[model samples]
Target: MNSKTKDAIQIILVILSILMLLYSIIYLVNYYSENDILTHFPSNKKSEDTDLLTPNEIGDSIGGVLNPIIGITGSILTFLAFYIQYKANKEQRKFFYIGLNNEKQNRIDESNKNIDLEKKHHITNLKIFKSLVSSMLNYYISSSQNIKDFLESEEAKPLGIHLFIFKTDSSYEYFNKLDFKNIYDSIVYSFQNKNEDWENDFIKILNILNFYEKLLAEMKNTYKIHSQSKAEKLNKVGESITQEIGYVLSDNELKNFDGIVEFLEIVYNSNPDNTPVLPEDQFKGTDFERLQDEFFNKYLEKLHMRYNETANEKYKSQLDKFSFMNKKIGVEKFQTVAYTKHLREVYENNFINQTNFDKVQEFLNKINIS
Candidate 1:
């Protein structure tokens, strides 16, 4: 149970305990009061008159004894609820163990599936990179190598092709990140997959690379659940995650990411002190005017629908550079920049202005200095 449920149980236990205690006290007091009123005797003789019921009243007392018994039972139930609440609060946090149980198998299966997907992504990137490199290599060979020698020096030809493929694949768009796809693409060109003897071997290597990626992501998510934000252990978990995904992280590199993660974790763990500083924290003492202009121009471009939505709120709000720019920047003086105008400034001049755009720009420029 979560904290909220535990609290509710505790409260219910307390209320029931109080209610049972009151019921017992009230029942006894009312029983005596009614006996005095109905006895048809003076108040001082009420006990005497009630007692005079003698053998009949004495033998009719089973219900009187059972009333206290039932009250005690309610008291026991109240205590049990309290006990359960305490245990839930103290022990419910053992989610780590839960994950290690049957959940482990589930995560493994999930990891395997993800690995397969990553393998496909890696394979595709590699195929494209390999095809490009091989094509370039073959062109070079045809232009310079003797046709007789090309067919004869088969190993040499593929060797050159593989090197070129490795180099060109690194420059591809989606494979730039240090991900499984990136690693697979990087190593894939080293194999002579285009040759008839090599296709199956390359396919297996692709599968292995993908498996590593999934294993890494699952471990990372698990660590995030229980790891303290400021603990260096969390960073180790993150580093492990990256390494699992095929990044060649050095011990020192892991240390660096660990330090950053620890620092960020501290901010998060501090609760009420939440927000982490922007990546632009190092901008002070730099040339302000140049930075402002660069900020302004970038802000203007951001107003365009094609520009990306920046997550950097500080940069977006503080600079005032983009204050005039709406979802589009309206150029009050597009021609004012004169002969010095870059094509970029000329294009931004025609951006439209509107109410909502102006409102967001004013406050955003005040806060974001990026």
Candidate 2:
């Protein structure tokens, strides 16, 4: 039975036992007095008043017989009361422990569920990274083969379209000055004047690039949840594509192209002890002066190591040089330099003020010495 009900029943039994004891004492006293039993108990006395015991003597005799019975009953009642209370306390303790165990089990279950969810999240991100990398490789392969085949063909030489013509100074705005659609259409139209096969090959390359340009926009959203290394590789591939195409076009032509600037801003903010002394941690608008200065500073820190290590003499010569540039820097440093520089020139420029130039000087003073 429940503890409460059991306690109530125990209370009733004790009360009833007390009432029965009281009733038995009252009934015996009345029966003895009414029958004149106490007065005749000795059997020698005839006169009622003289032979009957005194009131005090009768009271002592009654008490002598009843006290032991009452004591025994009281002892039994007390023991039962204690036993009932002990049982109730034991039930309460059991319930408490059961509740504690259930709560602990619930917390463990919740923790396990959270761990599973995190694992799924990690797996999903891995799949997304792999898929993006695969698409990037596909884009590279398809475009490269098409370009190579086109260049190797005799018909392509007549167009005077050496791939080198597509190369520009790393910071040039030759592509940004004009519209992408116009350039695309112009190239396609020029190909239309040639054989059908040439037109098809040129269109194929253009289509691949166009697809990648769209994919970059999507990567901006995905990269926020991915690892920094994956994002860095993505940024590198994007720069390589833009460099080979000799132009930043479409969404890539934006100042904060594909949110890459914002991403880099986060990186710079997260790393406070890094060697490069940034004037600011974020890009709020078209603050090209500060941005360009930071990029230039990173480039100088690289010491032209990438240019010297490159086997392609033409490619090495194409890199901008400074007396400060050399081969002592590491690959990671060169990548950081190149990536920052790419961010600076990927879009159009705005006029810089004297104050911006002063900020640039201050930034340079701090990092150049360090």
TM-score of model 1 (CA atoms): 0.24
RMSD of each: 38.6, 27.8
Model 1 alpha-carbon drift over 4 Å, by segment: 1-23, 34-71, 74-79, 82-129, 132-370
* lDDT (0 to 1) per candidate: 0.40, 0.44
Native RMSD of candidate 1 (Å): 38.6
Q: What is the Cα-based lDDT of residue 96 in candidate 1?
A: 57
Query: Against the hidden reference, what TM-scores do the models get?
Result: 0.24, 0.35
Which whole-number lDDT from 0 to 100 does residue 187 have in model 2? 40
lDDT: worst 10-residue window of model 2: 159-168
In the range 177-277, model 1's lDDT, one tens digit per residue, is 43655644544443424334343544543343344234333433433432232133323433433343232123333223322233233322212245434
Deviation (Å) of 46 in candidate 2? 7.9
Evaluated at residue 115, the lDDT of candidate 2 is 71
